[model samples]
Target: MTVGSRRGQATESLRQLTEAVRTESSDGARLVANIADNPICRVTVDTGIPCVVLAWGSYATSAQLRFVHECALDLLRRHALHKILGDDSALAVIPVDDQGWLREDWFPRALEAGLKAAASKCPNGFFGKQSVANVMSGAPVGITVRSFEQLDEAKAWLQTVKI
Candidate 1:
């Protein structure tokens, strides 16, 4: 077989593998939003919690963050979701620069979009947890953030948040 043909086959195989992984990962969740070129941030509406859920992949980029912010705001507006559950346990780290954008831009816009409360599964370590905590601290008044080690706990907390 020609070298170029071999390379084409390999690319197709890799694409199939990625699609398989994505299908398996999102098996139970209903996909609600997807941004072109930023498929890692899977936005779904959780049937169990009846809230919008942002499930992160292994890593996040600034462009992905922006996609997530915009998608979430759209979800909030369309569904009138008062609570958002961000499952960031799969995420490795929040970029230092994106942290400010999240705090100053995304968070406030979320509030204005009618999000009353949010729950995020804290990342696995002290530093990761601290990073999320720091961002949460700057959230606008009336917007509450609750951190949890488990998704169930987060969903439960979200259920109790008053609209």
Candidate 2:
């Protein structure tokens, strides 16, 4: 998963990006394409990996969850697209900020949803645990980065690991 966006841009409103995941293959490569969209999250899955680049301080609310559900469906569709792409490695990449999730209760629910989605998408239900191992192995996915600087570092760390 790689993240990139234009700098110093502000959004009109804050929204949440949440999704559900389903993997069609046990051996597939999932690459998350996290777009730098504000207000509404713009998530793209090139493979099964759903990469998301969100605004710094966007908030998640009950109304926002509906949007999350929609995103989830889109994420699943992208995973299916992975089958066509001919990549057979199952993986999930989630982006979040500690400031966004810890500051608000609503955010955690969305985060949980993302976690669940990632886990469910794993072919053997072992990808989630494997990701945890990856994290502890000096790299981590589904990690909460505090700022873009840290985000960049996290991305670098993630790049070291093969999906």
Candidate 3:
């Protein structure tokens, strides 16, 4: 695909993947924790970069965060992988309590699970960026971390990691 096409695809993919964030049911916010939408976060192994991918679909609650991270950790351990590509372009602001859970709970487990790298396409909004920063600030020391404006750029950096 052409660079422009790739960019367009990335944009459209993020939009579709995050559609759950824009609509709501009687239990709208609860979707972030359970399955109100078909998908709120997608975790999978992407062999192109030889890394696990964690793509968020909305502002996840602590429970949802746990589920996604556990999925990623399982992939990391099972495949002996150390990299993660996070698609956060449409991610909403993560709450402070959930942010703490990420740092205090998830990172340690992921590190023990053998994760060594994380790269994310950050969100455009101020609150979103701040929330990303909040979680990254508490990242464990061994894992490398980087942020990008585009998915391809993040993938390029991951390619250079020698993993």
Top-TM-score structure, candidate number: 3
lDDT scores of the candidates, listed in order: 0.71, 0.29, 0.75
Tens-digit per-residue lDDT, 26-131, candidate 2: 1111211223233333334433233332221232333332343344434444443211010112222222332232224323333433421222112122542353
| Better TM-score candidate (1, 3) | 3
The digit string of per-residue lDDT tens for model 3 on 7-86 reads 58745743543344434443334443444233567677889889988777766655555555655776788899999999
How many angstroms is residue 126 displaced in model 1 relative to the true structure, after the best TM-score fit? 4.5
The positional error of residue 157 in candidate 1, measured at the CA in angstroms, is: 1.0
In the predicted model 1, the residue pairs found to clash are none
What does candidate 1's lDDT look like per residue over 48-96, in tens digits?
6667888776565455455566667777878877778988787777777
What's the CA error at residue 32 for candidate 1, in Å? 12
* Per-model root-mean-square deviation over C-alphas: 11.8, 16.9, 12.6
Clashing pairs in 3: none
lDDT at 98 for candidate 2? 22
